[model samples]
Target: MESRPKVTPLTRPSARRSHVPPLGVHPTPDGGIDVAVAASHADGVELCLVDVVEPHRDAHDPARYAERRFPLDGPVYGVWHGHVPHVRPGQRYGFRVHGAWDPEAGQRHNPAKLLVDPYARGLVGDLTYGPETLGAVSAPRRPDEPDSPDGRWWVAERYGAPDDRDSLAHVPHSVVVASHPGPPPLSRPRVPWADTVVYEAHVKGLTATHPDVPPELRGTYAGVAHPAMIEHLTSLGVTTLELLPIHAFADEPRLVAHGLTNYWGYQTLGFFAPHAAYATRSARGAGPAAVLDEVRGMVHLLHEAGIEVLLDVVYNHTCEGGDDALHVSWRGLDNAGYYLHDGASPAALADVTGTGNSLDFRRPRVVQLALDSLRYWAEVVGVDGFRFDLAVTLGRTQHGFSPDHPFLVALQTDPVLNNLKLVAEPWDVGPGGWQTGNFPPPTAEWNDRFRDAVRGFWLDAPREGSHGRPMHGLRELTTRLAGSADLFGHSDPPLVRGPVASVNYVTAHDGFTLADLVAYDHKHNEANGEDNRDGSDHNLSWNHGVEGHAPRGAEGGDTATEPWSAVVPLRRRSQRNLLAMLLLSAGTPMLTAGDELGRSQGGNNNAYAQDNEISWIDWDLEDAARDLLDTTRFLLALRREHPALRADSFFLGTPRPGEDEPDLLWFDADGAPMDREAWDMAGRRVVQMLRPGPDDGDAHVLLALNGGLDDVGITLPPAAGGGSWERVWSSSWDRPEAPDDEADDVTLESLSVEVFLNR
Candidate 1:
């Protein structure tokens, strides 16, 4: 009954405000840090501060730092925030979000476990995963469940309780930084998507072994921006450097347990933070600020060299994993809102991604988080664009995948984002997940159909017989070579996506390299420790006259004890043919990194987990490798010179009224017109594509294909000017000392591709 001060309840409700303003660590005039984070279902939120740990240690040592917590005020629009006094750009911090612990309902919030700030722009160190730090508890496989590929997934349940596990010593804390994070070298290159050649390279792998890169700078951001690397990219005629994910990511705990690492950097932890591991050791010694400068400086130098930087972003999933996984950020802050959950049990995640969890696109705040992250990278970090990994998951709804999803629409219309180049992987492993060529205008999607079709013609032949499928037809190959109009342009309103929508490539980062495509017919993934069953078996590759590397054969082609050289001719010619098919096609072409230099992974198709020599590019180029490099540069230059080769629109097949000749003319092996009957031939293996000269250019291009086992005569179609055809380039270039055999019949050898210029 005496005067006792009223005690405040722990739960505080946040309301949607009229003018909510921005979130995350914004700098204030008084030199304090304004911290904000979005957590709708949280009962409370606190910004925790820790003493800056210098010379960062990896162990879970408690005596490393001091800790203090400050409760945030009213969460405007479900965003809890507060301005911390005496805080500057270098202050170290983390979040302790206090909420419910009901995993069954998909709300696994525990303040005892420290969480990462979702909007953290700079990360300090690597995530130290353990039983308590990772939170992924396991049990014996259940009898009722079927076996999984990894066996550990079939009966696994990510559900776990918030143990009173204090992860302060093990968990990495986010760093406070200046409100304006970067001054990217220049504005977005805004390269025309049609003219763009995406060179997909890993930050570390691209420069890790380059000889000219300073020993200390090798594998660092500086290495990628070094003059040596820049010269190679520029000489290759690549307009954009599409780097593999450099976002702050972690090696999957299971990958670590298997004695491997995530070399691809797909297991992202923080969307706004660059992977600090890729920075030079000197930069790490300096501080996080130096790391930021190094990354920004790389981008700046790239822009100066007339190149754009696009990030391969993995926003579909995070390193937080699922119910049994770690509570690094979103899972601990507001699990139910951040992820899609099973409607019936709620606790079980609706993981469309192979990863344990998929980001929920239905929630507005969740969409905002992704948008904010994209803006941070595009505007603050100065990246030209993004290639969204598992992009179908980003457009999914409760009803299934929707091209008209809110997130997709927002991406197309956002003032700042619409101008940026956006590419989608276009598929996931879930139901109705293959949405290739379905995404709307301006956003290009990876044309896997094109990839398979090219591979089908060049590598997978009917009689090759190494687990390869039969070739569809010469017409099928033409359809892909002409930008796969049947797939991307066959829409109700005519062509939904033009020729530019298809990113044509025979090889990508996910599958075999140009060299390995012809070197090994089967995958050898024993180093992954998964029993060689981790990668796809549909390689469509041929061993060309030997497996792995055999002894040289006698003059007639029989090997006794020496390594065989019989397969070498077909191998080199095949590499040139594949390269020609990619660049000469009428679509945006993407060249995988090191493919020009004939890079190989020792027949390993899936090297995602190999962080060593297996994944790093071998800079020491062999003779064949140098030839392939020169051939690649020649093809790229040809593509740039011939406007007819890079058509802006799909060919109508029939002649246009005003044109002197048809936009594109198709022919069979005997020079006859490709009628319906000829195109329908299942065994057909020869084709001739005649592209007339553009209005301004004089070069009329002819692309001929001979997939037959023996040489057959090819007749040139009559040209508009009635001029003879001249052989400009051939896939079967000088193999050692063998000149292309010229003949009156104009016969071509088996599996050969040739290009001609009609005067």
Candidate 2:
């Protein structure tokens, strides 16, 4: 192995008097700013002051602003000097630190590189990506290559030229505040955990081109809080709006090179600051409080409408990236201490997040930062809960991912966050990753099994013939519908059963939309600038007949205007099937944005890089799409009508009254008991399931699935006591009401699911 570069600790002389700029004012004691940067790092640091009086001050404004250099002393981090004059909110500022530049040893620092404050409350300007921002540094030369790396630094560069590519600088500390002032009083409707329905959406993509939302409000925080958006969410009967990451994030340098930006704000730079771009008004003109006030107002408005707010947080890694990355707060403060460094070298980071470095939860300060951020958002920001991104990373100690990790324990025991809904992404790109059921009882995780199994039984399995026949046994589907006890056992209480422990979903922001899943057999990500090598290969998708937007060559290239052929019916049926399975399942269900109205990614499975039409949800839906929306509303009503489907506890896999068999049973096409040999058969494509009656002994439900290519006869099981089975709902059928008694034994069509009730 090659030897690593030399490492050295840089130190600066202490000053007798404080020269740091004054910290901004705090409206409330709890909302005051903490100078964490001063206390954390011991390098040459200085705070740049931008004048608030000069409204249109530029970066080169010498008279209006000044830079004060400061040095750290033992114990006393720095002085605040209270709220100084001419230094209110909406001030643009940054930090200049003179540090070492040794990428081989994992420390790349240049005083010339203007850096953003890691804890800035708000941002002022947009980042300009290119080579001029790269700073006066050179890559180390390889022994085999004779060229000196020094010539690259002094080369003159043009704005759009290839050599000027490194000039693109990321505005790391540009934080955006709510446009209005003060946190809105908590007035949202309170729905119990068992009855909660979560609707996950992206603020920008959800209404970027929405027709109903006002043009000014579209694609902004104000737009999402508009009456149109609220009415839509309310109509769907969603109790909580689980938003994707909204914190101020940095657009990757490479994405900018490809003329794209980070659609999902996962690369966080400011934990306390909201992304200003999502605000309808400009942060510079409206003031920092404008952004802050608008966000709080949105939360309050949603609350008033009986909805909860759950923010998706990303704390696994900072936007600063790798060793050669920028020296933002965490890296400058104490790189080795704040990040997970190699055990052997101590100064080298152990890149676990695949985004460069993973935060060191083992450190007391690092753990405190995370806990404090969470509490700040929940209490100060007035959010209902948090969905942690790569949560397993925060739970890892020296041993492994532990439920007793300090961060987990703190959240479970924290007074402020304990009552709030706590959710976890459950896994990171690290060793011992993919911890689905391993989260503490207090936190609910996104159930990947639910996503895969449901997709497998309905679409993936039948097309590929992977999991012993394309369609699974009714016994297996019943277990999933009633909550998977096999995955989450009885180790926890009924209130914390596997069902409540999981957040069920068929599609999410990371993969294909519900529509695209039923329209594309393979991923089409050639537009991602990676030659289709960027997205996941195991999509588990199936194209009904065509691949991209056009029909396949095998179908004689028919371009008819059929409902299913045009992506409308397929989207509706797939969404209805997925939603019915999700809401009717025992776990809490989450609905993706626009899935209720048949949104499509144009058959693009992975759209992480496509910030344009490929990722944005088309708010304008056709009549068929409107019908799909109605179907979603109807399904939500059905879910709300029955408590059995959303039980906090898992139902025992045993026989029940009002049903001929157990709470769950596997049956063949003839409605006969399925044997082990039959269950293992790879060609089996049909199964029937029976859900036990509610605890109060109300009605029983029988679900049937057929993944075969042709219609098949399905014999009805003998009804319990003296009742007869009635067809209540079918994916192939249009109406909500069941068919007449004349169809006792129904013929199920290919790629169809039906629900029957015993009356």
Candidate 3:
């Protein structure tokens, strides 16, 4: 990367203290049409009015348009006044500034760059990309050439391009002008954390290729709220649809080069604005209100289904990168104040996001901006909650990451956000990045441990010579299944308790889909165009037989045929076992999109840049996939039916009222108590868990799992309160079978799980 230009307070012009002009169509103090552009660094600013129908060669055609130059007494801080006869909404204009371009000392302010309005609510044309767009300077003569003396001049050319004639003709110039229309009136569903089951999904990928969704509505907000989509989510018993970021984001320059996009939508350009691409109606002709209405409609429909809407928000940084960055909103408004700069140097940015810059949460105004944006989404968009991406960056102050940082404190105390479900990714690529369990009370975090543990148990442990020991034994797995109290038990009030505090998952957007987890061991990222150098190395995954592509039914190999074929039967069983473990756990269980239907990324663990079929959910599934979905549905229903499994209090290894047995009990293959030796034995595979009855006092559950290669005999402990054991559901069994009401013991198949009720 090229070294960023240094910006010093003393060397730069007094324009550093300029203010941002207000946005939107509003009457002036005199009740006349008022238009202004906020250009803080301009010595002399001119608003050029170009004829929409004229060609570039006809610049001298006075018959079509005109230009007005406004000399500034100082840098135009807020608004540069242009009265009725000159400017108004729908007027197309561009800015020309007069400043310095001294590259040696880091002051590159070419008046010819033609800056976009920082407060522009809409964009009329696509940014042209090519060497000619780099201004008057020539392209680097050679590939490895460094920034030449005229590099700044070359950079200026790429700054501005003529708007697309057709795209611009249809788009009104005034549409780009910001308007401070007060918050939209929105009806919100107030659901508590205990009753909420969040379903995390991608806005575009979720319905983009769904056959049931209309072609026009595919990958848009309308698709998300389509009757079919709503009905499906409602049928799944989802209480909250936690959408990945829908904010306007820029495709990374590299990913774009490879014909891929930032499908995950993590790179945000505007916090308060929605991504125009996700809108069914064009933002250009229909305007921001149209987009807002569609988004609100989606929220309304979800609310009508009694499901809440939550947004995964990225506030760690702005899309405008380093010194070579665009003068977009925050970077233009106040780069030094809005972004975290090296405290010692005070000129270079401290990039914690690895996206070129990190927002400075220490700055009060920046903190206010984040808080204001959160409020805007929650109030204006009618969102029920927010999942902060790389949230550790938001809570960091000058001293380091603080639990009581002003931004966090403000969120915790703010009346509007107080009751909202606040979740955090919890860490960033900064010093002390692994702060998984360090968040303050009431903030649920993505439990990476749970993901690893479950993956280890069902996939990694089954494959021999996989380096790590198999997690087939009960103790460690049981702790994760019970919410990992060891990691979250330190809070004074114990905020991260029960089902509301932990977002348990086996897969997420950043990793392989559940199917791929059981199909591949190493990341195959050659498609990322980095010579397979990109993506993480620590997959902790295993392919049962063959490695990547293998012949069908090839004996002794881990290929999809032999060992991989065996995986087919084991995959569904393991999936159900994992799903049962997640739903029955004491934390909030999050289901990754398409995990229910067995979506596979073709063993490509990292599909960040694969936006094609490899990343899109097939939706079409085989019989096994259907079976997995049905099993998940049944497990979800079981969780809904039992409050004891989802209790608000942490299990203390003690019995409940009217039950002589502890709330949870561990048993070995022979139905005997699991002693220390048995718990430590690496050969142990059969384990059983018993949960006490709920408030009804008539329900109790016995969950048994046999990971061995053959059937294992299990003796049932004496029934609590003189009741007999009855099997309610089993992964190995096709239908729900009543347990042997008279028997004290039963045998379970290899790699199977069974859930029983006491009568």
Candidate 4:
């Protein structure tokens, strides 16, 4: 059991005193490679060397390589280590751990299953969800059961006897890469939390259909760094580009069977390896190292443009899925130590992430794995921050989620991770999972409250007795505009996490685009092959006068030839209103990609599986699309210039040093300050918010909104120093080309937003 020898092996006097190698395949100074793995319950571990038969063969070809197994030496502190002579870069490998197959004790080790190293820096090929990849056999189908069209007969009996069929041909191989996997490290943009305007985008969907991007680079990492994309982001005032998962992932078997794919990239396979599919054709052909360089190059270019890069990392669960899923990695390597269990004889996995399995953060090794991965991305790959998907699950313990959990504490105290931006999705499917404001300081959260409040104020139609008003009143709207102080403002330790802790967003990747939000009252997810019952029904949306204005090749099956409805103007106004609130509020704002272009999925709220035209951003903009883009750019630029809009701290309603006017003042339509009666009125549709600029020399800003269907004359409140109000922008106009108007009494159009500055 040895590798094809070129150099002689080095030996120590005693194996007990020999030093253990670090985990994963690391090339040593000597002409050999050191391999280490933690297989606590395994009887033996064998390192398999793979020789590629054809370099450019199909990624999933079963006979793509020939493998030779060599036994490794260890069990020291439950870790296995070995050195193979003459191993060099680009060598493909995997591991086989031999141990007891007693699922009752949660030891699911199967030598028959070849496992990818969890710490592999480079991985090639994709996983096939065939019988070879499963740890256990499918249960016997009853006479009444229906046949599986995909040959996935029935649910797997995970506790039954192990399936001895070899899985070497079904899964990917871990490649031994050079120590420096990516390009030379570049300085990170390191954008401040308060000043960051995050633009959430999918690497492929962002520029897949862009007319300006070259055909060779489209739908790849190189496409993201294209000058056209860079110019768009920079001109739009985006300070950060938050990418969806770039980690290697696998499409769920169900999605494969349905003839669809997981376009969201949430199902992670290898955390260390970049998804090769995202690289250009030349890079993929060049091998795994080239793919890494392409990813690094994108980050480098984005950083050069003064934009930060944040990764949406999914560490809550692996792509291996649940009890009835594949055994490609952790499940086969160390099932008991890696995953949470329900305390049964044959322990059932405790799944908090909807993806089927939840990793146990209680284990030190598991926490180490997460911490190591974070450091690698931050230091090696040069990313600015991370947004944890299903973050609540990472902080969960036996008693439930705790802010003081070891993993969370470690992140806050770690030297390499503490300074980076840490954002939490802040919820899971588990009990007490909605811990929105419970995370510790410095950890920002996605504010669903902001999304709902803004959407309700602008999109929901008037209810009975509400006098043509939207569902929410002045109080709700004002609260969100002021940064939802009740949620983020804490008194236990005054301003522990200020208004900046809230990431305000009206629409995100999971739901409808901003355009669809104003045009569809219900979700059209029938394209997902789950009937119409797959997505959320409580959309809190209003279709206005028409059911939909389907874009070209929309997934909802609507025709593009349908005439525009009369309510089109109103829908555009509502989009402007939502965007204004999101950008002008006293919190960090996150804009979804393509919202600026008024992109639509034809009312398909859940387009996660629609990887084609429905999900890819259509860059061929019409007149209306161009107008919306201009509006977004104008709003973003205004927010950047005005410090009052993106206030770092919450307003206290009291006067600041040497200022007579309060830091923030509320006014009624009559130019008088709002009283208790006005604040509590449900029929009130118009409200004014006045905020002082950063300094006395700067102009004070006032935001006025009319949520009613008719015109409302708003009497301008005198500035602290007494000056006329200059109307700089209005949502009534289709674009921001309207001239600035100076007036004391400004009439606001129906469902419109207007901003004023006192000169």
Highest-scoring model, lDDT: 4
Q: lDDT tens string, model 4, 412-528?
A: 899988999989999999989898878887789999888888887787744222344344555777898897788888646877687889999999998999999988878888787
Error of 1 at 8 (Å): 11
Task: Write the residue-wise lDDT of candidate 1 on 536-601 in tens digits.
Answer: 899888777576744224312343343344567777788888899999999999999999998888
Best-to-worst order by TM-score is 4, 1, 2, 3
Q: How accurate is candidate 3 locally (lDDT)?
A: 0.65
What's each prediction's TM-score? 0.92, 0.83, 0.82, 0.93
682-723: candidate 3 lDDT, tens digit per residue: 767788777777555657777887766668888877677788
Per-residue error at 567 for model 1, in Å?
Answer: 1.2
Task: Compute the lDDT for candidate 2.
Answer: 0.67
lDDT value for model 1: 0.79
Q: Residue 713, candidate 4: how far off, in angstroms?
A: 1.6
Model 2 TM: 0.83
**Candidates' C-alpha lDDT:** 0.79, 0.67, 0.65, 0.83
Residue ranges of candidate 3 with Cα displaced over 4 Å: 1-124, 129-187, 281-284, 325-327, 344-346, 465-474, 495-499, 548-565, 655-661, 673-683, 707-710, 733-743
Please give the range of 10 consecutive residues that has the lowest summed lDDT in model 1: 147-156
> How accurate locally is residue 684 in candidate 1, as Cα lDDT from 0 to 100?
83
lDDT of 2 by residue, 505-559 (tens): 8888888888778778888887776667677777777775556543333211254
> What residue pairs are clashing in model 1?
158-323, 158-324, 550-563, 550-564, 551-562, 551-563, 551-564, 552-562, 552-563, 552-564
